[model samples]
Target: MKKDITIPVITDVYVAVVNEYNDIYKTQDWNAYIINDKDVDLDMVIIVTDGYSEKKMTSVFRKKLDVLPKKSYAKIELMQEDLFALNNRFKVSFFEGNTMYDKTYVFRKNTINLKALQNIPLMEAKGVLVK
Candidate 1:
């Protein structure tokens, strides 16, 4: 029975953390973005995010979008510097046409620092990408 079920593979979609200037606070803040690199659009996009560690955890945050167009990206959340000490996770789910797909991406504790920043697809800003 298990062999009969086909699980779709998720590709070209990713969650990243970028450092950007905040207009309101006039500060450089760490922000999360959902990047869609596929040729098709993603519908009913839902992302649940949280940060945790050995003895502590942050509140879970949920963000929804009607659609994410092809080769584009959307901002999900702003992460504080303190949360960088915890392992941050992003569970993303969406529909590509009639099929639904989901995947979890994680940024391990203490690994989101400046050294990890690199070229991200479809975005000029460099950031840490989950493989």
Candidate 2:
């Protein structure tokens, strides 16, 4: 029954796009990161990334992590500047103990620019976050 179902509220988890200096290229690059700000560890983390618009679409990308420790982060992918024009989505799923949780984070079209940068919690650097 609907009344008996439990829907967990996801908090403290976030997807952020940070612009950092690339040592090999000697240039700034945009990268995606998954931040786990929760107090407990998360297990079996899976993230699916995709992007689309009316006239264009991107290939689906998947990333997996065995465990994400408390108050830590992992780099998901290197986001190209071209992706900024499309609506990007990141679907995250993971487990806390015996319970499973999932959520989707989206960065709307043209929303990943410098104008949208902010202080990303736990990551010390500034970037665009979809919480």
Candidate 3:
């Protein structure tokens, strides 16, 4: 079988429990059967931006997750629409470095696992690159 080629980009990926509103939870209490169950369906992975400040971003990101539902899955996916929106929201000015800001891309949970979590790779090419 031929191995697929993957291009790397700038972004961080994480696995967490997601709710119907697309909220993410990293705490133990928020843990749901679907996330813990190996047989459950893998939904979408949310790719959040690094933000201007890591400390502030962490708090904001956590708050974003807190708003999500705890018992359901969010239908949010990293698609063209989301990409465009993210691109506009994350500007170069958002960061201290002189880097161009591209919307973060996240994989659907089905494509990720423990091993995958060890290293979350970013997509290099422009636009949404789904596996």
Candidate 4:
């Protein structure tokens, strides 16, 4: 099989575990974000834990993004309880221009610095894309 190329300009990826409060549900929600940059449109975006299996660490989050438009990004909330942890591997797969591309990101709990967390709302609200 041929290997797909990684396009750096296509999308800037960000992974984070956030604490969100649901007004409707009246409960605290922990979510993970798979933010993509706005430069390129991404399709079939799938985020999964590396070394995933039925027995251990089998968490997969999939989304079909027809287009992640430029100057804009997408946020995917992970359902998994434990989002921030060491040795957590996240594999992101998507399609760009008919070519399927994928990359694996390892989390070390310190993945998102304190400064980055403060900017999450700005990023989400203002379409601020960061890497």
Best by TM-score: 2
Per-model TM-score versus the true fold: 0.96, 0.97, 0.21, 0.58
Clashes of each: 0, 0, 0, 1
Q: Which one wins by TM-score: 1 or 4?
A: 1
lDDT of 3 by residue, 1-131 (tens): 23574433433222332221224543312111111112222222232432222223221231112222323333222322222222211111111133322333334323322232231122111121221
Residue lDDT tens for model 1, 12-91: 99998988777998998888999999999999999999999999999999999999999999999988889989999999
| Candidate 2 local Cα displacement, residue 14, angstroms | 0.5
Q: lDDT of each model, Cα atoms only? A: 0.93, 0.96, 0.25, 0.54
Query: Sorted on TM-score, highest at the top, how do the candidates line up?
Result: 2, 1, 4, 3
Candidate 4: residue 112 lDDT (0-100):
36
Cα lDDT over the full model 1:
0.93
What is candidate 2's TM-score against the reference?
0.97
Better of 1 and 3 by lDDT: 1
Clash pairs of candidate 2? none
Rank list by lDDT: 2, 1, 4, 3
1-131 per-residue lDDT for model 2 (tens digits): 99999989899999999988899999989999999999999999999999999999999999999999999999999999999999999999999999999999999999999888899999889899998
- Model 3 alpha-carbon drift over 4 Å, by segment: 1-93, 97-100, 119-131
| Least accurate 10 contiguous residues by lDDT in model 4 | 121-130
Candidate 1: misplaced stretches above 4 Å? none
Q: Model 2, stretches more than 4 Å misplaced?
A: none
How many Å off is the CA of 6 in candidate 2?
1.4
